[model samples]
Every structure is written in C-alpha cells, then in structure tokens.
Target: MTEAKRIPKRSEMDPKYMWDLTPIFESDDEWEKAFQEVKAYITQCQALQGTLGDSAESLLKGLRLQDQVNMKLLKVYVYAHLKKDEDSTNAKYVAYNDRASSLANDIQNALSFVVPEILSIEEDTITQFLQENEDLTLYRHALDEINRQREHVLSASEESIIARAGEVTSAPSNIFSMINNADMKFPRIKDENGEEQELTHGRYVHFMENNSRRVRQDAFEAMYDTYKKQKNTLAATLNASVKKNIFYSRVRRYPSALEASVQKDNVPSKVYEQLIQAIHEYLPVFHRYVALRKKVLELDEHHMYDIYVPLVQEVNMKYSFEEAKDLVLSSLTPLGEEYRDIVNKGYESGWIDVYENEGKRSGAYSSGTYGTPPYILLNYQDNLDNVYTLTHEMGHSLHSYYSRREQPFVYSNYTIFVAEVASTLNEALLTDHLLKTTEDKKRKMYILNHYLDSFRGTVFRQAMFAEFEKIIHEKVERGEALTPDSLSELYYDLNVKYFGPDMKVDEDIALEWARIPHFYYNFYVYKYATGFSAATALSKQILEQGQPAVDRYLQFLKGGSSKYPIDLLKQAGVDMTSPDPVRQALQVFEQTLDEFEALVLDK
Candidate 1:
C-alpha cells in the first residue's frame, strides 16, 4: 500500500478559491469600523429604559431602535466568529473571536432592559400597541414568546449581571476545547501494511473504516488512552460546568438545572424522560444488533472496540465530491424545485468550504446568520460518510435559506430543538435513496450497514450520553461531588445498561465522557435522539405520502422560530410532545436490523 500524501497547508491554497469574507466585511478595517459603531449603539440602548414607558409612541420607537442595533450587532459578531472558527490557531483570528465575544456580552448587558421593561407594561397595553401599529405586527410572534415567559423573566439589573457573566460561565467548555483539540495527543497505530500512522480527529474515521480489525482496535485504544490520562482534569472542568448550571437554576428560581435549561426552549422535562424510557424499552433491539455483529465477526467476546468494524468487509461504492452533490440533489428532489435549486446553488456557489487543510476546524457543521448564506464547513474525503455529511449540512443550510427567505430576521433563526431535524432528515433520505438504487448485493449490504451504524451512533449512543448528563446533574443537584471515580462509575454503569450482555463495558470506556464536548451544553444530547426520531417520521411521510407531506415539511422549514419548536414539528406531522415518534423510529431501527440479518444469511 502507498502512503497517503501529507495534507497541504492552508497558506498554499490560492486566495480566490478560499471563502470570500467580503460579503461580511471588505477588510479588518471595515470590521473595526462596525465594531466602533456597535460600541456607540450600546449607549443608545441605555437611553431607552426610562423613556420606553413614557408613552405608546415612545415605547414603539425605543423597541424599533433596539431591534435595529441588535440586528447590526448580530451581523458583525457572527461574521467575525465564523471567520475565526475556520482557522482557530491563528492568533489574529483568536483575538478577533475574543473581541467579538466581549462586544456581544457588552451588547447583551446594554439591552437587558428591553425585555423586562416590556414585560412590566400591562399586557393589555402591549396588546393595544400591537393592534395600533403596522410595523410592530411583524414582531407579534417575538413579543408573544417573550410575554409567555413573563413569569421567568428577570429584572434589568439581574439580567445584565447574568448576560455579562456569560463568558465566565462558558469557561469549562472553552477549556475542554483547548485541551481536546490543541493538547491531547494519541499514540501512533500500525496500519495494515505495518506503516505507522498518527491518530488525529480528521483521520480517526478513516482508521475506523479500515478493513483490518487490529488497525481499528489499535486506533481506538490509542485514542482513548490519551483521554484516560487526562480524565481527572476533564472531570474537574465538567464538574465546574455542572455547578454553574445548578447555581444559575437556583438563582433563577427554577426547580432544577435540567428544568431551567430545557424550559428555555419550551421543552418539557417529560420530553427528556420519555427519551430515556423509549430507549430503555428498545434496548433489546440494540442488543440484537450487537449480537448479530458478534456472530458475523465470529468473536468469542465482543469488546467495546469491536463495535465500529464493518459487518460487511467489502464496500465497493466510492463517491467523489461531485458525485456526492448529485446524489444529494436526487435524494432531496421530493422537497420540490425551489429546494433543489437552492441546494444546487450551495454547491455551485462558494457556500461550502470543502476538504481539510492544516488548520481547518475538525468535524463538520452548518453555520451562518440571517445576513449571509448558510455556509457549510466540511472535512470531505471521497466516501459514503462524506456524502452523508454533505447531505446533513445541506439540510441545515437549505432550512436556513428557506427560513430567512420566508420570515423576517427576528424569526429566521430556529432553535436547537428543531435544528437537528432537517440535517438528520437528509441523512435518512440519502440512506433510503442509496438502498433503493443499488443493485449489487455487496453495495446493498454496505448501505444497510451504514444505515445501522447511523442509527446506533445518533439514536442509541447519544441517548446514552443524555442519560449520563441527566444522572450527573441530578447527583450535583443532590449535593454529590463529580470526581473522576464517581463520574466513571456512573458512566460505566450506563454503558452496561445501553450495550447489554453481548459486549464488554470496559473500565477505560468510562473515560469517554471526558472527551465529548456536548456535555458542556447541559442537557443537550437528548435532542439528537429526538431529532433523529422526528426526522425518521418526516422522511417516511415525504416518501410515502408525497406532495402534501412535502408541503407540510417545507412549511415547518419556513416556520423557523416563529412558532414553538414542538408546534413547528407538529405542523410537519410529527407530534414530538408524545413518545410515539420515538417508538416508531425504533421500530424502523428494528426493521433495518432485520434487513441486515437477512442480507448476511443470504450471503
């Protein structure tokens, strides 16, 4: 086997092919100019508080000015941060990020008076103001949502303190990223040809895709060993983050940190509980899949590292970037001509920064604000995983594109509760598309394996993370410490519950919690499971019911944050408030497992 060439440095690329930042600002001088303007607007925000209640006209004027300032600030901050995230190692970019974050904190502090002051006004008075003003009609949804949370809304001074302290609260997450990306180093693994390869975030998936079991096990153990060494420090950082949640919850009069975090997005605690219950009820299905893997691999005992090695040894399908684009277009055709056209533009235009360079951010994401095109950053290589990733990010981009086109700026940005749905929906459709078109038996088995792997990772694995997050928070809420030993014990037990009898839940695997960044976003992992469930339902509707389902799903995409996330998903024909969607999704998982089993038997 030939050695893979060293990845090129970012500076070696031609400037023209790089992302055009001029749409955000012409130069650093222009960004600095806007930064100064935003600073001046902070003073303008301070002038609005007392005068807002003087008269209806004064209130309207104050609110409009506040919205204008906020919109401008968003444009400035989002551009700076997105640019910085592309190459975070650059000192100039890091400084830009830090400055923009500080400016955001300052702006939040200055504008904290707006919500409380609005809430202080009599509800009937605000109602009459909305009835009288044409311009305020566009803000009806925004105002109503704020009013709905009137009981939880804080006074201006209190909110200002909280807003200003945002960066300090994010310290744990920031430190985790710094250590995980910049400091952690894994041992080199010997490949199939006995050549040594250094493990990296970009190459981890490639290593997992290797046909050799030894290579996969070496890569896994080498990576986890590094994490195991730093477990104590990571546990401390995570504990600090959990305590921050508890402190905020108590300060805000919420019953618990989980309640406080979930209620912000209008999610019920029952939704979180239901995810755990549904997954627990369906553990048999997961165990069955694991058993099938064990049988196929002929292992006397399946270890944790054995999970990722492909069940089907031969995968012949290879997709170049252009081929992946065409596949995404074909799979998404059910969404209509306009949707397809927008996706085409994302590919043709410079909306995507494709491929990994020396300093590009690891992993994949879809990010943009209301003022810019929804830009996708991907570390693309020619494989099925990259194809799925492209579809997923495009799902987010097109959702943003449609939402911004259809709604006002205030409503264009959707919540995270609904954010993953579009992305996962695309993944579901892409899998269905591949399974339908492929004729060769080996290719069919590969696609089926891919589908099963997605279900396992997104639904099952994330639910495990969710359960761990909930348990740790409850322990903190009950006055228990989050030491490395305590956390590892909790994590190890949960792994035993999730993976069942077929596999060994190893001691070192408990250290896995330290490596996952999502835990920092308290109570956030449950949404991944719920999002996949909702997407499975929506995709089935679009494929089986056709045009009417397509229209409803499109409406949900365009709804953005105009409605509550559950209400928005209800319009798409999935009632996530109930557990039926999750049950149905798990049923689909079972069916896929059955297919894989039969495919293996036939071969």
Candidate 2:
C-alpha cells in the first residue's frame, strides 16, 4: 500500500530551497541585538522632536536621524515578519513578530512629531533652508508631499496619540492573519487519481484547476464550507477592520477612508471611480468570454469552480521550478540585458523561498526594504499558473532592485498604486513570448486561455472586489453594522453582476470574502485592476516599439516614489488618469477572446 501525502516541515526541506535570511541578520541572536539597538534609537529620536523647525540644519539633522532609525527599524521588522510567515505555528517567531510589530508602533510614535513640526515651518524659511543646505535638497519632493498633507497634520501630542494607537488599529488584520495562517484547518479531499490528499490554502488552487468536475466541486465546497463555519467571527473581524479605516479617516479629517488612502499615493479618488466605470462598460466583454468558456468546455451549466479550468485540456502545461525560471528569464530578454541579468542574479543569490512547507504562508509576494535583497516567497506548484506567479513576483522584485540601486533610500520605495504595474507587465511579456514561440494550435489556445483568465481575475474580478469594498465601507460610514448574512449577501450579489447570467454563482463562493487577505488592506485591490490595464499598454509598446520603449520602461521602474504614481505611468507610456489604458486592455482581451473562439470552435 502507498503512503498518504503530507506537507514537509521547514527543517525537512533542503538548505538550497530556503531563502538566505542570514544576509539580513546572521542569526536570531543578531536580530535580537539589532532590536535592542533600535529601541535606543527610538528614545534618541523622541528627544529631537520639537527641534526640527528651529533651523535648516536642525531640520536636516532631524530628518536624517529619522531616516537612520527607520532604515534599521525596517530591517528588524522585515526579518522577524518573514521568519514568522515561514512558520506561523512556531511560537518563538510569533512572539518575535509581535514584539517587532510593537517596536514599529514605538518608532512611529517617536517620529510622529517630525511631520507636524515640518509643516509648522514657514514656506519661505523652508525654501531658504533648501537653498542654504545642498544636502537638504534631496528631500524636495518629500517635503512637498508633507506640505500637501498640511491640513491633516495634527498637533505633536495629538499625532503621537494616533501613532501609539497603531497596534490597536492594526489588530483586526493581525488577528485575521493568525487565524487564516495558523488556526484554520481544511478537510482532506480526493485528487484526480482518487487518492485522499489534505486540502490546503496552497493546494486549493491546484484542485480547483483539476479537469475532473467531481474533484473541483469537492475542493470548492470543502474550502468554503470551512470558512462558513467561522463566517460570523470572520464577519466581526471584517467589521472591526472597516470601522478601523473609518476611525483613521475621521481622525485625519479626510472626507472618507477611500480619499484618505488615494491621497497617500497622491492619486485622485476619481481614478478609482473611473476604473470601476470602465470595467462596468466592458462587462459584456467579460460575459462573452464566459460564454465562450462555457461553449468550449461543452458544459451544460457553468459554476464558479468551472471558471478556472483551462479551455484547452489537451495541453496541461506544467513546469519544474528551474524550467519556470528559465522561461521567465528568456521571456524578459526584450527588456534589455541588464534587466534580465538582475532577474538571473535574484534567482541565483538566495533571493527566493521556493516551496510551500508546513505552516508557511500561502500565496506569493515580493518583500524587502532598501538594504536587503528583494526576496520572494512562493508556495510553488509545478504548473503553468505557478510559472506566471513566478514571473509576476519577479516583476515586483526587479522593480525593487532597480529602484534601490538607482534612488536614494528616501525615494527607494514605490507606492502600492504603481507596484502592480511592474508585476502584471511581466505576466503580459511572458504571454507575448509564449504566443510568438508556440506553433502548435492547442498550446497557443492554452496560452490564450491563460491570458484571458488573467484579465478576468485581475481586471474584472478585482474591480468587482473594489466595488464591494466601497459599498461595505460606505455602509459602515452610514452607521450600518455588517453581519455575516449581510456581508455574504452583498458579496454574492456582486459575484452575480460580475460573472453574468451564463455562469452559476454558487452559494459557496459567497464565503470567499472571509478567505481574502486583501480586503483588510485599505482600498488596495483596485490597484491590481489599474496596474493590469497600464501593463497591457506598456507591454505592447515594449514588444512593438523596442529600445526607446525599453529605455523609458526601465526609467519608470527606477523612479520609486520620486514622482506621483500617475506621472510615473505617464513616463512608461500609459496615462492611467484617463480610461484609455483600461479600454486598451479590454480591447486586447476582446482580441484574444475572438481568436480563441475561432480556434476552439472551428476545431
């Protein structure tokens, strides 16, 4: 008899497969030492609070000290959090992570006086300071950003109070993370070969994409059924989160939480509204794509579980990690040698945690600060979707790489608004490369299906999620409480509107809101849609226009937060302020859908 499968523990994995966190700190003991030193820096920073507006030199000195403390704080915080994410059930790292989070609040409380004090200085004096101190000129844009928030800047003591409230305000997200990552357990389900396999957050997607309807249905029901059991508790956590956003926005004197969030990116809230409008206009296009999927699969009734399975089942494209890396590198050759070389370096230099292990986080992301390698965490499965996941995350890491290499630490980090563009652009380039290279009809059809699904998930579905966030927050703003039933009902309705009548919006899918980690993020999912739109346009330019386009694109990656996200995209050859990019992306989706229909239907 064969043994049942189980997830391997972190220790069971080979050293080469793990990320080298030693670069951040040689060991946990070293990290603890750094942690103690940062606590001292926080005290020192608190001493310099009221001195920032005294003179240009004082202002520069205060700013530099704050930066110095933040630089160290970032390393300490990231190391602890990454270790915690590696194994959420590990009690040692959990305590370390909690303390690190509190340390972050302490640092924020320490430095909260800096912004209000800078805003108190006279405009003419600040200008003169810049003129007198050349070193102070580096913060020209940063100062301007602060001045723009002058209305929201509170008194020093008031700001400190809010800063210290950070841990309380962030509690909902933290609780959700712990429950989702460590406490939640999914049931075992049978795989395609009829062997019992434990369903996991990492394996859920793999099962959803299985060709067998029985397998897909079983996994879908099992996943959501688990969430359903905790639906009320999950609802309370989400309610607390929405209330948190409302609290901060009101405290900061913004009109709404949505406006407050966009203001940080220096983005107008109208852009967010415009993205939803454009997707609404193109809902028919998405509906048509769904119709085509149904016809191609020859299914009598299409459920949400049926949405993810590839239309071309004849070609189940799977790749080993090494093969996926090579394909991603080759696909990115159009970006010039330097860009490709950095991606190669990231692959070789221990910048990635390659596989999912017991208690590790699910999903993939690129994370780091200025001084560290832009590390990627991937729960890799040997499938084509995971290949796209690899490319997408490397897009982010490459953006981090370029920005850190080129910009000052002050400007090294980009906003969440423009972050998705780099990642989605990589996906587009990979799709383009695959289409051009594949001569076989089935493989090409398969590639088109993947591209179409990427659009549906990123643009249409995320826009749907964006709308849901807006609605839920608006309800909270109006003093309505969100119960499990109401939240599930609202989510179910949105799914129906977005998926169209041809698709069956299953009851199980309504509990999806409980499983999503992004909903806790203040108005963040919308950027995924906008980023997809911008990337579709930018990738077209790079493929069709060549070197000049590549040069412009490279410059955009290195821009960091030096310019507003809108202006950065303008430099990359797409204007996200208008609906043109979103429309252009939909047009590409239409074109792909048309071709896909011709091939599969004709065959």
Candidate 3:
C-alpha cells in the first residue's frame, strides 16, 4: 500500500464517507449567517425577559421564541462541534465551536430572567395562564419542571454569575484534557511480535489487549509510570474539578454534589445510591469472573495489566468499516423496518465519519441537533470492538432520528440519562446475532465472554467508580483533603475490594484513577451502570417478547425528553427505581458465564 493511502488526510478522503453537514447549513457562509442570527435571537430573547409576567400571550411567545433560539443554537453548536471533531487541527472549525459556545453563555445569561420571572409569578397565575392560553400548553410540562425547581432558582444576577462561572469552572477539565491528550507521552513498547511500537493515548488500550503478557505489562507500566510522575498534578486537577462540583452544588442549594450532578436529568439520588448498593452485592460474581479469566488464560497469577487481554483470543473477528455497517444494520432488524431503514440510510448516506485521520477526535459518538440528521464520528479500527462501537453509535443515531422526526423540537432531544441505553442495546443485539450465527464453540465462548466482560465493566465496574466518587465527594464535603497519595490509597483499597483477593493488585493500578476523565464528572458513572441494566432488559424483551417489546422500545426511541428518563425507561418495561433490572442483568451475565465455562471446559 502507498504510504499516503495507509493514512489519508481529511481532504484526501472521499466526501461520500464523511457526514453531510450541509443539510444543517448549506455552507460556511450560511452557517455564519445563522451564527449572526443566533446573536439576534439572544437579543430577541433578552427583550422579552422583563415582559414575561405581563400577560399569558407574552409568556407563551417568550417560551416559543426560547425554543426557536435554542434550536438554532443547537444547530450552530452541533455543526461546529462535528466540524471541529472531524479535524481538531482546523482552526476555522475550532474558532466556530468556541464562538458557538460563547454564544450559548450569552443566550443563557440573556434568558436567565425568564425562569426566575416566571417563578416570580404566582403558581395559580401561571396555571391559569396555561389554561387560558391554549398555545402555552405546549410548554406546560417544560414550564412545570422549571417551576418545580423554584427552591433552587436564585436571582437573575446569581444565575448569570453561575453561568459565566462555567468558563472558569471548566478550566480543570480543559487543563486535564490538554495535559492528557497533548502533553502526556508514553515510551515505546514491544508489541506481541516484538516490534517496538510507540505508545499514544489511542494505542495504550490496544496495547493492553495484546495476547502477550510482556506487551500488556510494558504498556500498562509505561503508561502508568508516566502518570505516576505527574500523579500530584492529576490529583490537583481532579480535586479542582471536584471543588467545582461542590461549588455549584452549594450555590444551587442541592443537598449534595451528587444530587446537583444527576439533577441535570432529574435523576433521583436514590438511583445513584441503589446502583452502588446493588453492585456491592454482586462484586463477588465479578471477582469470580476475574478468576475465570485467570484459569482460562492458564496463568499462575494475573496482574491488573492482564485483565484486558481476552481469555479466548483464538477468534480474531476483524470487520472493515463497510462490513461492520452491514453487520450492524442486519443485527438491528429486530427493531423493525422503520428503524432498520434509518440505519441503512445512515450507512449509505454519509451520516458517519467512518475512519480515523490526523487530528480527528479519538473516541466515537453520535451527535446532531433537533432538525438535522444525527452524525456519528468514529475512529474505526476494524476489530470486534470497533464493530460493536459502530452498532452502539448507530443505536444513538437511530434514536435521535426517530425522536427528532416524531417529536417537536422542544421535546426532541433525550438526556444523557437514557442515552447509553440506546447505545448499549445495540451492542446487546449485535452480540445476540453474532453468537447465534457463529457455530464455532470457541467464537461462541468468546462472544459470551465479551458479554460478560461488558456487564462486568459497564454495570459492576461503573458502579464501583460511582461508589468511589461518592466516597470522595463525601470526604471532601466533610472537610477532607484530596491529595495524590490519599486518592491513590482510596482507589487501591476499592480495587482490592472489587477485584477480590484472587487477582494480584499491582501498585500501578492505583494510578488508574488519574487516567479516568469520568472522575471529573460528578456522579455520572452510575448512569452507565443503570443504563446497562435498562438496555439488558430492553434487549432481552425485544428478543423474547417480540413485536410488543419492539413497539415499546420504539416508543422509547421517540419519547426524547417528553418524559423524565426513568419514566421513559419504565414505558419501555424497565423500572430503574428497583434493582430488579440490575439483578436480571446479572442473571444474564451468570448464564453467559455458565455457557462459556461449559463450552470451554467441555463440561
């Protein structure tokens, strides 16, 4: 292959494989026009601020205009973000993204008066207005949700101060991102073939999944050794991020930082606590799975570095991006014709940026706006994981497509709370299809192992992180200091508890906390645990309950933020309030484990 062909520039790639942003904005000129329009809309919203309490018509008009401006802003922001992500090196797109973000803060500050002003009006008056102004009924639920947070709603100045503080508060994350992605470097390590491979953030995970113990260890140690040198810096950055959380929580009058964080999607504190509690009960099962890995790998003792390399590496399933598209679309047929057509269109219609290029974002995500087709950015690697990622992201894209097409702009977009369910459900379906079609016992065993590992990582492992976050926050809340040594000790103890005494917990594993960006996100990891449980239940229902379940799942895809996330999942037949789904998901994991052990052991 030509050197240029192996790694092509964004401009070198065919436009057919890239996402069509023109649907949202015909050109940069048009986008620039919309950008100016965003400023005009902000001024327009600001004009209606003080007059909101004057009449029902005024309130209704302002809310509708708010929706319009938000949608326009979303279009601008999503476009800029997608463009920036496509090629992070592009200064034009980066500036557009930065400008769009500033515009958001301006809009937020300008419209800060709307909520507090509406809250200033009597509840009965607002209700009567909604009753009198039939048009205002469109925003009735949205208004009610805002009204319900009256206790937390501060003055306009206070809200604007908080809004503006976002830029400053975001510094820790920004610093961490720059340091982790840009400044940090890892030394070259020998691959499984004994070839020296220079380690990058992107290659570290891949290196750990190598079949050779030496490669995994070298990669792990080399990665962490670098982190170890900067442990104090990372800990300080994390502490600042945590303090930012505490600041907002305290300012917003939330009882705790965790509450303030999950409150974004109206998730209850109990859901977060319940996830940790349930996972604590199942840690033994995860440890046993770890033991199973050690036995299968035929290792006398396996360290933390050995955890990632699959037990059954005999099945090397590599699908090109094109083949993965076909696999994803075929696997999703259970979702019915409508959803399948959307996936097919996405595959054919350049809705995805399918391959990696210089300066593109490293991870995968489905992003878009209320009116436009959702776009996915992926660094496709052609491995089994990449195939699952294709399905996962397509799951998100289809969810956005159905939701935006079916619901009004006001309720079109879903929250992150329910986002993971759609993504993970795709993986579940893809796993089912792969396992059912693959007759080879080893591949079947590998697929089963994949499912189990997914459950362990997503449900149990995230829950463990959630628990750690909770503990640390509580400590901070209680006037405790967070230093590198202190955080490491806490993290190491958690690992010991979670992984059990069977596996050797290496010293470098404690530094793993420093590497995780999610720790900076307060009380967010539990959602993945809960999302996995919900997705597991929904995927099972679709496979077994057939059309009826598919019908409900389709409803969920279209519901968006029309309802609270938990209620939406409840509509899809999973009650996240109870730990039933978590247990049910664990039961599935146990069953998969049993099958894999039976097959591999010839039992």
* Candidate achieving the largest TM-score: 2
Question: Ranking by lDDT, best first?
Answer: 2, 1, 3
* Runs off by more than 4 Å, candidate 3: 1-16
lDDT of 3: 0.84
Model 3 scores a TM of 0.95
1 or 3, greater by TM-score: 1
RMSD of each candidate relative to the true structure: 1.9, 0.9, 2.3
In model 2, which range of ten residues has the least summed lDDT?
Answer: 1-10
Candidate 1, residue 356: the lDDT equals: 72
lDDT of 3 by residue, 1-603 (tens): 112223357898778678888899999999899999989876687678688888899998888888888989989889988887787668788789788888888888888888888888998888889889888898887887897688889997788788787767878976786567546766877777666767766566677778888888898889999999999999999999988999888988999998888888888778887777778887777788888888888889979998878878767777887788888888988988978887888877778987776566667789988888889988777677778888888888888998898888888989889988999999999999998888887788778887887887788778878888988898899999999999999999999999997789999999888988888767778888888889999999999999999999999999989898889999999998887888888888888888888887893
Q: lDDT scores for all predictions?
A: 0.85, 0.93, 0.84
- Candidate 2 Cα errors over 4 Å, as ranges: none
Which candidate has the top score in lDDT?
Answer: 2
For all candidates, the clash counts are 0, 0, 0
Question: Candidate 2 on 425-480: residue-level lDDT in tens?
Answer: 99999999999999999999999999999998899989999999999999999999
lDDT of 1 by residue, 251-313 (tens): 888999989988888989899899999999999999999889899989998888778777787
Error of 2 at 263 (Å): 0.7
